[model samples]
Target: MNKLIGKKKITMENAFYLLKRIGFYKALKNIWNHNFEKSFLNKRFEQMISIEEKKGKEEKNEKLLIDLCECYLSLNNRFSSEILSICVPCLLKVGLKKDETDETQKEVEMTLLALSEIGYWEMKRGLYLNEIEAIIRYHHEHHNLSRLAYQSAWQFLIFRIYKDYSLEDVIVNELHFGREAARELKELRESVDWKRKEERGKEAKEVIVIWRWINAIDNYLTWCALWSEELVGFLGSIVQVFREVKDNHREVIYKCIYSLKNAAESRVIKVEELLKNEAVDVVLEEIHQPKLYDKMTYECLLFFLHISERLKEKEYFESDDKVRKTSKRVIFEKIEEEGYEDIISSFLETFDSLNIKLYPYLSLKISDYFVNV
Candidate 1:
């Protein structure tokens, strides 16, 4: 039904041309009953690859191929390892060929997800180390796969690299490259709310299947941003994206703020201004109002405190005496006035654990105040 060659167009035969595609939910349920048996999994992979080979010639087959991948994913995990092993390389082969088939991107996402699942399963089975070095080498060689698959591949790759290499080795050999990958993530973050977001949000939009690929991109990019220090270079952009989302969706914005906090604490960035500015104020406002529907207020506060503590210790922006002074004053006052112990305690705890040093004056003042009050 599909005739695709290289990176061209999708030509569908009359038999499959006017297809009324089944819904993902229905397909998901249907695949589950198949038990992921060998014959069914092999047949599915063969059909998927056959279609992908023919799909580069036309774009329509892209949607069908993506659907097939999802259906295969929803099937039992029995076939996941083998299916993924074949699919991962196949997707790389197709995606790296300079083709523009939406199907190719779709397949790339399927492959990344499959690999992630495989990696997770392997880790659980404690069989990860045997293949981890090979996986890292493969990822390093095919780093271009970063663009084709879900952005989460970056994290998968980083996790793999971390598993294979020691901390000192990562700091020496892979750190720079890891930071570069994190920069690529920043680009993806900046594009999320572009005008395309609204168009992409439209339910009737035809590229619905391809949209999954986009989401995977976002997740992967966010993961990279979460795991690397290169993010510190884009503090302004991260704040801007957080503000954009915060203005529209408070809850999601808070979560993003927390993510930024975790990333910053991981030494991904130096984001004092972001946490010290209106974003922190927003968190304070939410804390005061106390919405039961969304209980992430405490989590956001913890994230804020963690990053703030990190910055204080690292002294990345020592010149911002105002932010530093204000944060200490706020925490001291909060602890003193309401007996809300978490404010200073969380900061102190994270600071001690990370071995980050705070300003001598600020530290002395807080200690003295606590000693007296």
Candidate 2:
């Protein structure tokens, strides 16, 4: 893409149009691979955002708007805080809105993905916390848009919180030393209050939204090493909910696994706690269920690595006692103890074969793990 740009004089509109043609994922790769001098992409992104703010809701051009937001996201990782700030008003409006058609719906999905990717970048200005938080509270589970919305919001919060907490401390705060943090988290949990409506009965939309938030919060929390009693208790609640999951409850189970992944990945929650609470066992049972989605199964395998890597990072389960080693043997020790080797092998094979698009970082990690395994 940069080759084309360098060889030809491409206008901002043309660049966006070409990005629209090449697709979102490729556009991201293109931006990552090449440097657009003189803020070429930045100007284009600002222009598209300007247009979206001025006309996006009034006249929703599905193709153009989707491509534009995706183009901005393609360069989002390096985008300035000022540029990233445009997301709430511009992209979130489209992302958070309920879709009017199947075509428009997919575009909306892409828009939320764009927002999420942008959120993955650190927000230095700290603007629009209320607006972005509103996305989670009001629009996160807007029909089928929950995963992307929740993910976007989660990334946003994670990046912002990183400013104040060390990664190690973030993990620590979420774990044993987080009594005050637990209270804050509890209030945050109460703010959503998803269960107030959930206990009424299993209305699918309400159930999905409730579970979606549960799933989203956990997924967001997974990356942090932080584990508090409140957080653990919250996760245990999801595990209980997972035990009763039915076929229509596929998303619920998927989110449940997503929530458990942090515990698995970080090891901050501890093996005894996982067993005592039955979190690990319940997730493993769900993973092996024939009815579980293939994508969920893939993530199950992916998170096994998550668990082992965290142990390696924190110097747990180390046989060498000296150097930090991320060895397969260390991972398998836990896997073997849990009777998970065969299922893990099968799921990793399944995860390897799939054409995954999101979580490129995890995809690369999976490939490296397989090569070394």
Candidate 3:
């Protein structure tokens, strides 16, 4: 039966051995919702310990040791985690002190990796919450585990919290974390290493992460508008970058322009000129098939209408009769021809909320139209 676990061939004994080797021992510990104890996991611990002891401190023996250790750890048992949880830290101290070698680094990396994998598995499968908590606490406190470690620990906690917490609680907590992360992200963005331009045919993930980070920065600026000049400056800088792209940079350009249109304190004549220019029309034409993420086409039109509405409000309030009448007629005609019911509806809702009295002539005309309808 013991030999079956080591065999490459199929057999009931081999299957049990494979299972026990992986962390089946720990999984079984939870079958009855019982607390994991040392005695219950003694066999798995002994097996893991035996590999390290037999291999000793030899560099060449590292791979063999890792393999044997992984086979034992895969049992996914709390007993195995507890045993490894103690063993790994001790091995790190001994391995680092004896030889600051690649093999030693590998030892530390693999052990932490194993722990991370187990924690991920538990979090993914929705079992052993306490065990997952222990793994996170341990990993989080360790400051030297590489960037991957920080990323891994963050991903683990987020998964568990997302699954377990209420939307309100999660949102409040994210805001706290977001503030700190935003600061760090700002520093990274300004660093020379944080290149904003994508190389031709860069992997989708890299491109997407860049897009999201830029958007996050934009969001932070808009959300913190009254608090700082930084957000506005960041938006302006991004617009400049968008203007420099030689290749078809419409997707990113559209995103930047849309964000600016929503949040810019003053309407940018430069962006307006760009939109009305022949070049932008050519770019928009090329993007005939719209993407899920491509709302720039519609947003640009909406932004123009919004600015027109603001201009109309100002003109009418100042009793500038010609300006108010001209703006209203142009906007009304466009809306009617385009059948932009949604934008028209939003405009009406905002007008209602603000309790704005339109110019008497326009007000009487809209009232008659509604009466006829």
**Residue 255's lDDT in candidate 1:** 47
Model 1, stretches more than 4 Å misplaced?
1-84, 101-119, 123-152, 159-162, 165-229, 264-294, 304-373
Alpha carbon deviation, residue 256, candidate 3 (Å): 1.6
What is the per-residue lDDT of model 2 for residues 87-165, given as tens digits with 9 covering 90 to 100? 5455666655555577666566556555655434565433545455555555423434433344444444455544544
* Backbone clashes, each candidate: 8, 6, 9
Give me the candidate number with maximum TM-score. 1
Per-residue lDDT of candidate 3, residues 83-171 (tens digit) = 45444444333222223356554444444334433332223222333343444344434434333223333333343333444322332
Pairs in steric clash, model 3: 22-74, 22-75, 22-76, 23-74, 23-75, 23-76, 24-75, 26-77, 26-78
Candidate 1 pairs with clashing backbones: 4-54, 9-57, 9-58, 10-57, 10-58, 10-59, 151-220, 152-220
Best candidate, lDDT-wise?
Answer: 2
Candidate 2 structure lDDT: 0.52
Model 2, residue 280: distance off in Å is 1.9
Error of 2 at 312 (Å): 9.0
Which sequence of candidate numbers ranks them by lDDT, best first? 2, 1, 3
